[model samples]
Target: MTLFGTTLDAEQIAALLSLLALLVFWLVVLRRERGYARWFKQWEADRKARREAEQAAEKRGASPDGRKGPWG
Candidate 1:
Protein backbone atom coordinates (compact mmCIF):
# COMPACT_ATOMS: atom_id res chain seq x y z
CA MET A 1 0.00 0.00 0.00
CA THR A 2 0.91 3.72 -0.16
CA LEU A 3 1.80 5.61 2.97
CA PHE A 4 2.79 9.31 2.79
CA GLY A 5 3.16 8.89 -1.02
CA THR A 6 5.58 6.00 -0.46
CA THR A 7 5.16 2.26 -0.23
CA LEU A 8 4.82 0.86 3.28
CA ASP A 9 2.79 -2.19 4.23
CA ALA A 10 0.89 -2.49 7.53
CA GLU A 11 3.56 -4.79 8.96
CA GLN A 12 6.31 -2.31 8.09
CA ILE A 13 4.42 0.53 9.73
CA ALA A 14 3.82 -1.53 12.85
CA ALA A 15 7.50 -2.46 13.04
CA LEU A 16 8.58 1.14 12.65
CA LEU A 17 6.17 2.27 15.35
CA SER A 18 7.35 -0.45 17.70
CA LEU A 19 10.99 0.50 17.18
CA LEU A 20 10.24 4.15 17.78
CA ALA A 21 8.31 3.39 20.93
CA LEU A 22 11.07 1.17 22.27
CA LEU A 23 13.76 3.78 21.52
CA VAL A 24 11.84 6.54 23.21
CA PHE A 25 11.04 4.39 26.26
CA TRP A 26 14.65 3.32 26.81
CA LEU A 27 16.00 6.84 26.32
CA VAL A 28 13.57 8.26 28.86
CA VAL A 29 14.32 5.53 31.39
CA LEU A 30 18.11 5.95 31.06
CA ARG A 31 17.83 9.72 31.37
CA ARG A 32 15.69 9.39 34.45
CA GLU A 33 18.13 6.91 36.02
CA ARG A 34 21.02 9.27 35.43
CA GLY A 35 19.11 12.17 36.94
CA TYR A 36 18.20 10.09 39.99
CA ALA A 37 21.81 8.98 40.44
CA ARG A 38 23.07 12.55 40.27
CA TRP A 39 20.46 13.69 42.78
CA PHE A 40 21.31 10.85 45.15
CA LYS A 41 25.03 11.68 44.97
CA GLN A 42 24.37 15.32 45.83
CA TRP A 43 22.14 14.32 48.69
CA GLU A 44 24.75 11.94 50.02
CA ALA A 45 27.42 14.63 49.89
CA ASP A 46 25.25 17.14 51.74
CA ARG A 47 24.33 14.59 54.37
CA LYS A 48 27.97 13.68 54.89
CA ALA A 49 28.96 17.31 55.21
CA ARG A 50 26.24 17.95 57.78
CA ARG A 51 27.19 14.89 59.76
CA GLU A 52 30.84 15.93 59.83
CA ALA A 53 29.92 19.44 60.95
CA GLU A 54 27.76 18.08 63.76
CA GLN A 55 30.53 15.77 64.89
CA ALA A 56 33.03 18.59 64.89
CA ALA A 57 30.71 20.77 66.91
CA GLU A 58 30.14 18.02 69.43
CA LYS A 59 33.87 17.48 69.82
CA ARG A 60 34.54 21.19 70.17
CA GLY A 61 31.70 21.84 72.58
CA ALA A 62 32.49 22.40 76.28
CA SER A 63 32.97 19.35 78.52
CA PRO A 64 30.34 18.28 81.08
CA ASP A 65 31.81 20.83 83.55
CA GLY A 66 32.08 23.65 80.97
CA ARG A 67 35.73 23.14 80.02
CA LYS A 68 37.35 22.83 76.55
CA GLY A 69 37.76 19.13 75.64
CA PRO A 70 40.69 17.30 74.04
CA TRP A 71 40.15 18.81 70.58
CA GLY A 72 41.11 22.27 71.82
Candidate 2:
Protein backbone atom coordinates (compact mmCIF):
# COMPACT_ATOMS: atom_id res chain seq x y z
CA MET A 1 0.00 0.00 0.00
CA THR A 2 1.04 3.61 -0.60
CA LEU A 3 1.30 5.84 2.46
CA PHE A 4 2.76 9.35 2.33
CA GLY A 5 4.28 8.56 -1.07
CA THR A 6 6.00 5.49 0.36
CA THR A 7 5.17 1.86 -0.31
CA LEU A 8 4.57 -0.47 2.64
CA ASP A 9 3.82 -4.20 2.59
CA ALA A 10 0.85 -5.62 4.47
CA GLU A 11 3.04 -6.84 7.29
CA GLN A 12 4.76 -3.46 7.60
CA ILE A 13 1.44 -1.65 7.73
CA ALA A 14 0.15 -4.00 10.37
CA ALA A 15 3.28 -3.56 12.45
CA LEU A 16 3.08 0.25 12.15
CA LEU A 17 -0.59 0.25 13.25
CA SER A 18 0.17 -2.02 16.18
CA LEU A 19 2.96 0.26 17.32
CA LEU A 20 0.72 3.33 17.03
CA ALA A 21 -2.03 1.66 19.05
CA LEU A 22 0.42 0.64 21.73
CA LEU A 23 1.76 4.19 21.98
CA VAL A 24 -1.74 5.63 22.34
CA PHE A 25 -2.67 3.06 24.96
CA TRP A 26 0.39 3.78 27.03
CA LEU A 27 -0.16 7.54 26.76
CA VAL A 28 -3.71 7.23 28.04
CA VAL A 29 -2.72 4.88 30.84
CA LEU A 30 0.14 7.10 31.97
CA ARG A 31 -2.06 10.20 31.99
CA ARG A 32 -4.68 8.50 34.14
CA GLU A 33 -2.06 7.12 36.50
CA ARG A 34 -0.48 10.55 36.88
CA GLY A 35 -3.82 12.04 37.85
CA TYR A 36 -4.34 9.27 40.38
CA ALA A 37 -0.90 9.88 41.84
CA ARG A 38 -1.59 13.60 42.18
CA TRP A 39 -4.95 12.97 43.84
CA PHE A 40 -3.40 10.49 46.26
CA LYS A 41 -0.67 12.92 47.21
CA GLN A 42 -3.17 15.67 47.92
CA TRP A 43 -5.34 13.27 49.89
CA GLU A 44 -2.38 12.19 51.98
CA ALA A 45 -1.42 15.78 52.71
CA ASP A 46 -4.96 16.69 53.74
CA ARG A 47 -5.19 13.65 55.99
CA LYS A 48 -1.93 14.54 57.69
CA ALA A 49 -3.03 18.13 58.21
CA ARG A 50 -6.35 17.02 59.69
CA ARG A 51 -4.61 14.66 62.09
CA GLU A 52 -2.29 17.43 63.22
CA ALA A 53 -5.22 19.76 63.78
CA GLU A 54 -7.04 17.14 65.83
CA GLN A 55 -3.99 16.57 67.95
CA ALA A 56 -3.59 20.27 68.51
CA ALA A 57 -7.21 20.58 69.58
CA GLU A 58 -6.75 17.77 72.03
CA LYS A 59 -3.71 19.43 73.50
CA ARG A 60 -5.76 22.61 73.96
CA GLY A 61 -8.39 20.67 75.96
CA ALA A 62 -10.99 20.86 73.23
CA SER A 63 -13.16 17.99 72.06
CA PRO A 64 -13.31 16.78 68.51
CA ASP A 65 -16.78 18.32 68.15
CA GLY A 66 -15.51 21.68 69.37
CA ARG A 67 -17.54 21.38 72.57
CA LYS A 68 -16.03 20.96 76.02
CA GLY A 69 -19.16 19.40 77.48
CA PRO A 70 -19.38 15.75 78.50
CA TRP A 71 -21.77 14.97 75.66
CA GLY A 72 -19.19 16.11 73.17
Candidate 3:
Protein backbone atom coordinates (compact mmCIF):
# COMPACT_ATOMS: atom_id res chain seq x y z
CA MET A 1 0.00 0.00 0.00
CA THR A 2 1.11 3.54 -0.73
CA LEU A 3 0.88 5.80 2.34
CA PHE A 4 2.34 9.32 2.08
CA GLY A 5 4.29 8.05 -0.97
CA THR A 6 5.90 5.34 1.12
CA THR A 7 5.26 1.82 -0.09
CA LEU A 8 4.51 -0.70 2.69
CA ASP A 9 3.34 -4.27 2.59
CA ALA A 10 -0.19 -4.98 3.75
CA GLU A 11 1.04 -6.96 6.75
CA GLN A 12 3.47 -4.21 7.75
CA ILE A 13 0.75 -1.57 7.47
CA ALA A 14 -1.57 -3.63 9.63
CA ALA A 15 1.14 -4.17 12.20
CA LEU A 16 2.01 -0.48 12.33
CA LEU A 17 -1.60 0.53 12.74
CA SER A 18 -2.11 -2.05 15.46
CA LEU A 19 0.94 -0.82 17.32
CA LEU A 20 -0.21 2.78 17.00
CA ALA A 21 -3.61 1.88 18.35
CA LEU A 22 -2.06 0.01 21.27
CA LEU A 23 0.17 2.95 22.08
CA VAL A 24 -2.79 5.33 22.11
CA PHE A 25 -4.81 2.95 24.29
CA TRP A 26 -2.01 2.68 26.85
CA LEU A 27 -1.53 6.45 26.91
CA VAL A 28 -5.21 6.99 27.66
CA VAL A 29 -5.20 4.34 30.37
CA LEU A 30 -2.11 5.81 32.03
CA ARG A 31 -3.62 9.30 31.96
CA ARG A 32 -6.79 8.08 33.63
CA GLU A 33 -4.84 6.12 36.24
CA ARG A 34 -2.76 9.15 37.08
CA GLY A 35 -5.86 11.26 37.45
CA TYR A 36 -7.37 8.64 39.73
CA ALA A 37 -4.23 8.56 41.84
CA ARG A 38 -4.27 12.34 42.18
CA TRP A 39 -7.93 12.33 43.15
CA PHE A 40 -7.36 9.56 45.65
CA LYS A 41 -4.48 11.42 47.22
CA GLN A 42 -6.62 14.51 47.62
CA TRP A 43 -9.43 12.44 49.09
CA GLU A 44 -7.06 10.81 51.53
CA ALA A 45 -5.69 14.17 52.65
CA ASP A 46 -9.17 15.52 53.23
CA ARG A 47 -10.07 12.44 55.24
CA LYS A 48 -6.96 12.83 57.36
CA ALA A 49 -7.72 16.46 58.05
CA ARG A 50 -11.26 15.59 59.09
CA ARG A 51 -9.98 12.90 61.43
CA GLU A 52 -7.52 15.28 62.99
CA ALA A 53 -10.22 17.86 63.50
CA GLU A 54 -12.40 15.28 65.20
CA GLN A 55 -9.58 14.28 67.48
CA ALA A 56 -8.87 17.86 68.38
CA ALA A 57 -12.49 18.52 69.11
CA GLU A 58 -12.65 15.46 71.31
CA LYS A 59 -9.66 16.63 73.32
CA ARG A 60 -11.36 19.98 73.78
CA GLY A 61 -14.35 18.26 75.36
CA ALA A 62 -16.60 19.07 72.42
CA SER A 63 -18.47 16.65 70.20
CA PRO A 64 -16.94 15.99 66.80
CA ASP A 65 -20.25 16.96 65.18
CA GLY A 66 -19.91 20.51 66.54
CA ARG A 67 -22.48 19.98 69.26
CA LYS A 68 -21.80 21.06 72.83
CA GLY A 69 -21.09 18.36 75.40
CA PRO A 70 -22.96 17.95 78.66
CA TRP A 71 -20.32 19.94 80.48
CA GLY A 72 -20.80 22.88 78.19
Which predicted model would earn the best lDDT?
Answer: 2
What TM-score against the true fold does each predicted structure earn?
A: 0.75, 0.76, 0.76
C-alpha local distance difference test of each model: 0.91, 0.92, 0.92
Which candidate leads the pack in TM-score? Answer: 2
- Candidate 1 per-residue lDDT over residues 1-72, each given as its tens digit: 787899998899899999999999999999999999999999999999999999989877847666664755
Better of 2 and 3 by TM-score: 2
lDDT at 58 for candidate 2?
Answer: 78
> After superposition on all CA atoms, what RMSD does each candidate show versus the true structure?
4.6, 5.7, 5.8
- Model 2 worst lDDT window (10 residues): 63-72
Query: Candidate 2 lDDT, tens digit per residue, 7-44?
Result: 99999999999999999999999999999999999999
What residue runs in model 2 are displaced by over 4 Å at the alpha carbon? 62-72
Candidate 2 TM-score versus the reference: 0.76
**TM accuracy, model 3:** 0.76
> Rank by TM-score, descending?
2, 3, 1
